[model samples]
Target: MFTTRPEIAGTFGCVSSTHWIASQVGMAVLERGGNAFDAAAAAGFTLQVAEPHLNGPLGDCPIIVHDAATGAQRVICGQGVAPAALTVEHVRGSLGLELIPGTGLLPAMVPGAFDAWATLLRDGGTWTLGEVLEFAIGYAARGIHYVPRICATVQTMRPLFEAEWPTSAALWLRDGGPQPNRLWANPALADTYRRVVREAEAAGSDRVAQIDAARRAWYGGFVAEAIGRFVAENEVMDASGERHRGVLTAQDMANWRAPVEAPVFLDYGNTRILKCGTWSQGPAMLQTLALLRGFDLGALDPMGERFVHLVVEAMKLAFADREAFYGDPDHVAVPLQTLLSDGYTDARRALIGEEASLEFRPGSPDGIAPRTDYAAAVERARAAHEAAGSGEPTVSRLGASGGDTCHVDVVDRWGNMVSATPSGGWLQSSPAIPELGFCLGTRGQMFWLDETLPNGLRPGRRPRTTLSPAMALRDGVPWMAFGTPGGEQQDQWQPIMLLRMLHHGFNTQQAIDAPAFHTEHWVSSFWPRGARPGKVVLEGRYDLGVAKALQARGHLVEMGGDWTEGRLCAIRREADGQILAGANPRGMQGYAVGR
Candidate 1:
């Protein structure tokens, strides 16, 4: 079997991320005696600089960390909440919109990535805030080679920015709109981080105190002030095709903080899969796993038509539940236990037929009726999504897709591990805050305007985000941390890697290198959500016979380019202290480094 690259192996540490620069930064942190937590923070911040179109300082992240010292695993909820002033009534009555816009300040939530990384550093890391942020600051100040995709994204939105977002035009088009593969600098963003470092240094010499000070500077101090002013002054265009002012205020930033919580996990034989709560799309993967547990997956070929069809059908059922039930658990009584219960999974599993089902079927849990007009909503969203004519290179068939996301995985010699997906805050998401050099994230676009649904827009409610990262423990020990960067396809790409590793005896690189596929058969989480019934998009690497066979079973099969499916990355730590890492070769960006 041909492999894109050898699995990186090391005795000290390993790092894998969506960008080579970020992976190198993580390795540098480990080489400098930082733990996995510190390395992850460094890599994560660096990703914001290296892949600015994919993510930025104002994005959100859901991080899963495994501490080898205490043998504990925890989830840091980096997803920000809706503003206290934002409500469904306001969007519908005041803004005269059916759904929250996918771009502009109206969809901005309190920036959460900075606080989450700071929290990780404060609690589990061994380095100062200054140390972890140095790479990002340097890259932003001195400039780094821009990815071609970044140039393309900027070009696509150039007219919009020039006409409606002067601040964005000034920043992105400063040098005649950043040339592809050319070095580009964001001095304002660099200064923003530098100011935070200065504020932290002013606090004290204690590392923990410095981290806390940085957090304060971000959420309550200068950064917050700038963001507040930008939103208040700007009325920008969004997915609704109308200009609207944001309700997010400086007080919201001051009132909000990232919280660390327990991860939801499922025991599958000897492996335990961990993910964030229902506030994210993480649990859908677990639900899919539960549905898959009753089947003899080991008996089937990993890439066979039967296996692909089964996984795709199971995902559709799981995502339907996601649309109907998944939300911020703090605000709603998510029947999580019931949804994951054996009986519930059994009922949902039975719905998967040999012939692909095109209808959206959200199971009735706890006697609660699933949303009656979900298909109608999907059609509306599909119309808008198609009209927008916007999509990233991968997973474009669904959603108001513009910017993508990024992922990072790290493991240290001490067995500390972290898996994080950081996204939102694309340059095209909103006008750049001139003072900050980054735009607000439009994550609130995931919130529906329908008050009847679980993910309805409400004051202070967290959006049901699509960003999900995964961690797995084998025999009560940290084993693997993995994730990717697709909006609704995040969970779709994960199971393939896991199934291959679990059933086919594939190594990390081999599993990641395998062809991948996903179904766009559910309502997307992004703006102008779209659903293509019975649509199965597969990489061309898959056997042609399999594609024909899937079509024979009622799937609307579409063949994507070989190596176009996923940018998955993974890192594993053995009990005996060996580290192995792998990265997707697709897009020619992701890399894994170890020594």
Candidate 2:
């Protein structure tokens, strides 16, 4: 079997990301003596510049970090929370709105990516805030290649900018917008970084103090002030097909900070897989593993219908539980222990049949009946999704259909590792803030309007997000850091690759290179939330017979472009100190660099 690229191996360090430039920047950081945390942060900020159509400064990021010396692993919760004023009564009763608008100011959460990176850098990195930030600042101030996707996404939002978002129009519409492969820059965003660094440096020379001060500058000072003013001042059109102002405020930003918490993990044989807490959909992969443990997966061909169908069925069950049980642990009593308990998984495993199951099933956790408030609407949406051609990839589905995401993975010589997925605040997500040069994220759109459900829209509760980053430890030691950028497909694709790598004896690149698939049977986490009961998007690289076999088993299979499935990046620390890495080749932009 052929692989897209060689699995990068080195003893020094390795960094992989969705964009090549960001990957190189992370490698440079490691070469300059920074740890995995520092390298990830540098790459993340650079991605905001180079891949603005995918992520922005105000986007959310969930990071999994392992410190080799202490042998401790933690997750940085960069997913922001809804505003205090954003309540069911406010939207439904006061505004006469049924659902949270998927775009514009109303759905803006307290932007969380900045503080999340700050916490990572302050806790584990050896670099200063200015040092980690300089890479992004350079690209934003000077220039970087404007990819075609970025140009097209901008064009899609052109009408919105011209009509209402004057600031965005002025910023992006300059020089007839940006042509593909042309050098483009965002001076306003660069100046924002400079002001942040200046204010942070004014606090003194201590590196840790500067990181903290920089956090303050974003959440409490200039960045917050500008964002609050813009959201309060503008009432813009959104996915609801209506105009509305935001509920987010400067106080919301000031009151919020990213928290680092112990990660949730499951022991699958000798492998201990770690994921973010219930606040994210990360544990869905863990749940999938728990369910898959009952099967003899190693006995099946990974590329065969048996494997794909089994995995797809398992994911539908896992994601069903995601919608029913996963939420902010801070806000609800998520019976996580029971959700992953042997008894529960054993029951879930029993539900999988030789044929694909179209029924939406979420098992009872601790005898509590799972509640999906919009369950009735799911079928109607399923039809609509089919009629609307649900198989289209995210970027093509832009403007409220959905926006894309980015991922990064890094491992240092000391064995410290980081896996992060950063997303939201796409140029199409909302209007740009003129002063700050970025828009607020639309993560609040993920919350359901019904207060009875676990993921209902509530004041200050973090939306049950789909931004998941993952890692795995072997024999009680940190080993691999990996993640992808396909929204609900994140966990699905991750487990498939892990299964291939662990069971089929495939290398990292080979596993990533294999044909991938994911189910949209569960309700989407984005705007116009919908589900296609038996829909599975399969990469066309798979044998055509596999598609026929799946369809015979009742799967509503959609054959996607051969190279249009996932953009995963991964890095692993081998037992003998060798660092191995792999990046997705589908997009022709992802890269792995080391040595």
- After superposition, which runs of candidate 1 have C-alpha atoms over 4 Å from their true positions? 385-401
- Expressed as tens digits, the lDDT of each residue in 279-327 for candidate 1 is 9999999999999998889999898999999999999889989989998
> Model 1, residue 538: displacement in angstroms?
0.7
Please give the CA lDDT of all the candidate structures. 0.89, 0.89
| Candidate 2 per-residue lDDT over residues 439-484, each given as its tens digit | 8889998898887678988888999899989999999988899999
The global Cα lDDT (0 to 1) of model 1 is 0.89
TM-score per model over all chains: 0.97, 0.97
Error of 2 at 231 (Å): 1.1
Backbone collision count in every prediction? Answer: 0, 0
